[model samples]
Target chain A: MSAIPQFGNWLSRRLQGSAAASNRRGYNAARHTDMAAEVWVIVRIFYAASLMVSFAFITPTLWKIAIAEPMLEPRWPVFWIHWVDVRLGATVLLIANMAAAFFAAPLYRKRWPRVALAITFFLSVALMLSRGYVNNSFHIWLWLTFFFAWLPDSDSRASLMDRRFRYDSVRVFVWATGTVLLFYTLSGIAKFIGAVPMNADKLSSVAPEALAHLVTKQLMISGDESVFGGLLVQLPTLGWPVYMLVIYIEIFALFALFRPALIPVFGWALMAFHIGIWFFMGILFPMQPLQVLLLLVWSPLALRPFSARGAIEQLPLLGSVVFWRRTKPNVSLMKFWWADEWPLFTVIAALTFLDVLPELVKRLLAAM
Target chain B: MNASHSRKNRGAILPLIRATTREKELDMGRKNNRFKAGFAAILVSAYTLVGGYGASFNFPEIFPFFNWALFSFPAKIYNEWVVQVIAIDGDRLSEPADVHLIDRFDHFGAGEGKVLREWGKSVEQGDLEAAQAHRSLFENLYRRSGAEQVRYRLVLRRSNPVQRWEHGTVLSETVEGEFTWVKDSGEQP
Candidate 1:
């Protein structure tokens, strides 16, 4: 019973310490921003490599369909297709898009190259999708590269603003990491929604049979059979636990923003999860796992082993419980985790509490 | 005096003075941190609201901010399409053999399967014009399979993944269509 009070006091101390750390990370703009810039440059180089590799991916198909394949019912107007002989244009733009990614990666520090790369990549992918060869892999890169391109390039000479407050590279990092996290989290939510009976309000338990069914279904559809895929079908319930972990990780991915520690943890978990899918399902979404690896698992922040302990200690409510230490509390006010001191943290707790507590509190008060 | 215990005299007042002094140091960027707090609120809300809207519905083709409905479609039973290439030796049907057409377009396994199914559906309904668009893609696939000239038969297979896995059973299979082509310089044969 006495330990409960100790837990509260420890939590209060941890929040105060974390608030200080977050402030330091924000205030030391040069240090953190430079780190982010370094990561940006590396990702740029990798993006370029990805584009160069696509040369092989694109040439084989050769957009023969552009001239021969019908495009009568494109999702959007085939204006780009109509602009310059669809086959010639797709060939030229795709080659240029890959070339641009290669060049843009190295010269991204220059403004025009970065902007040009974004637009060209967007156009090339959009053009391919418009031809109705839509792919899940394309959409993953489609959203990530385009939106992530907007993150502040600290070294860019061209993007030197006309007005607004200069967003430091670290904030840009949060925005980017947050975006990736949001992608996975919502995907998990989508799975939960899927588990429910169509047009129903309740979520049914995930049965082993269900996962087995999914494995069997993918194997037959793709014809890219794997012994592991066959095993999932044979075991009937081998995949539910693994499937559950994947859903939980994806759903809780955004919590990494508050904790910052789960960055590498989730990154590695997702990468492994993706590899499992590729081997078992024969559906290779190569770009998505690669992006998660680059942005989350191997980011500069994630690699900071010693300093990250402090960040790890800021894992919302669990930090204090996991890493307890005695500290004398001495401020004009007692610090609270869900308060102004830990503003970033407050949002997560506040949103959750607002939904559950405020209504309950209001009723309690009324009863009183 | 336990060695593992995290305690220092527990008197509490001496550390209190030290904490008071530390608070003053922490105040240097107090106002700036308030800005981070505000931005944090904005960031969380923007992603959840916008991305959540995309998730709750099915407008995935909208690009970057699309739904993540990867395997959300529940699967006890599903459909699989197979295209078997039959060799054309002279004027006779050279006895149909099982050809894994999917292996020909192995770069993107799942998507290529969907494309094959769409073309098969067109053939089933006698929509040759609609099917014409996919012919070249299939032609390239056939060429890659080292095919010289062949008749392609589309088969529709339906089964429960778990039942087949558990009991080594399949529900049903039916042939959808049979078609062939020949052309020059990257022509279909």
Candidate 2:
């Protein structure tokens, strides 16, 4: 009986030691993940800074050209230069930034310089301002790229104007909501004011009449019916309601930012809205892209809970020999798959190939 | 054994510190990411909405100040008027209508007839002789055919109105008594 008691105590001590070791392992793993994430943030910041500097130099000149020249002049040299500079610059920067994020292991070893960081931030803001006054669609993308590039890292402890930037997520949510609301309100006002002189009775007909005439003239010259011609004709009576609905959607989307549950619904609606515009009006607004980014942001948070539950439910399955054998049993897979040590060159090469394929095809076709 | 225990303690402490730092960093990172994501969302949405509006309306410029208020409607009006005038001119040149008759008078008033009458000395030099000879020929032909005043009413449609103007000197010759002239088997007064 004494031997039996001693054996029971020994088993208990062994179990306790194992639990402590497991806890330590888990802590170590969590610490490593945190470090990796910090590195990613720093990489993103540096990339953003670089892009901001580039944009600051380029955006103003582009703006001047876009404003001064007719948009559809069919000037080949102008078109080629603009297309290559804008699209290539943005794409290359995005790839570089993402690569930096994936392979942030080196960044973790060193602290980012405050002066350099501040300069980047200042340049980004300056780039934003250069085109903000114009309210061009391109500016939105530029601003977003800048914003994502400089998004605060885990280690940033500095306060803005001596006020700690707390609840940054909430602030972002509020800002997005407010901005969308403001835009919606402004748009509604512009339409209403513009159509006011026509009187209520003729107001509905005004846009249709104007659009029809414009379309007819364009068709006479080009022999191509505009995408919006049919829709514009059908929408004469529903103009005011349609306008109001657009405003409502914008405002509602802002609200959905706060209540993430409504996101899928709003996101779908927004997608549909963009598709409708594309088909009916032949306008490719950046709303779809924005929605995609929003979905990406919410993905980690919303999917985390469900995934956690799934992991818990499959804990027994994870312990099975089949699963263990299929995975690297002898080697720790986690150690081999450090997030910060991803091959930047591979990613860059892959992206380059993907981006260059269309151009390569075109060139080959031309040569042939 | 003591040194090994101390080393283990250090290892444990390092992990705890790292974990705490990581947690703080993650919290801050998440906050910033969230804020930026939201800001970006709003900006992009606004941009799209504005772009859609500009495209649909065919605003002269995408900017609010340079839109329809500044350019499009005015340009549209100018283009419409120019097109209408061009269409009218094209219609006139393609058909033979009252416009051709007006063109004839326009040619007579503006061409050789005006110069001859204003600068020449006598009726022959002035082209008045040609007009008189034609009038005399027409009068003789009418008299030989026994034609009198040919009465005609100028009718104009209500929907298509025409304006006419007349200014001329009239000559009257009065006879005190009725005189009969007999020529062969015909008598005319």
- Which is the leading candidate under TM-score? 1
Residues B126-176 of candidate 2 have per-residue lDDT tens digits of 465543433232222122222223211111111100000011111222211
Query: Residue A91 error for model 1, in Å?
Result: 2.2
Please list the Cα RMSD from the true structure of every candidate, rounded to 1 decimal place: 12.8, 29.7
iRMSD for each candidate structure, in the order shown: 9.2, 26.6
User: lDDT of each prediction vs. the true structure?
Assistant: 0.56, 0.33
Residue B132 Cα positional deviation in candidate 1, in Å, after optimal superposition: 8.5
Clashes of each: 2, 1
How well does each candidate superpose onto the true structure, as a TM-score? 0.66, 0.32
Which residue pairs overlap in candidate 2's backbone?
A172-B35
Off by over 4 Å in 2: A1-135, A154-181, A192-224, A231-244, A251-253, A258-260, A286-368, B1-189
Which window of 10 residues has the lowest lDDT sum in candidate 1 chain A? Answer: A157-166
Q: Give, for candidate 2 chain A, the lowest lDDT window spanning 10 residues.
A: A69-78
Model 1 residue runs over 4 Å out of place are A1-26, A29-34, A54-78, A131-133, A151-167, A197-205, A301-368, B1-60, B82-108, B116-154, B163-168, B175-189
DockQ of each: 0.14, 0.01
lDDT of 1 at A319: 49
Residue-by-residue lDDT tens digits, candidate 1, B6-88:
36545556688788876875663444455555555555455545544443332224444455556655565556666665645
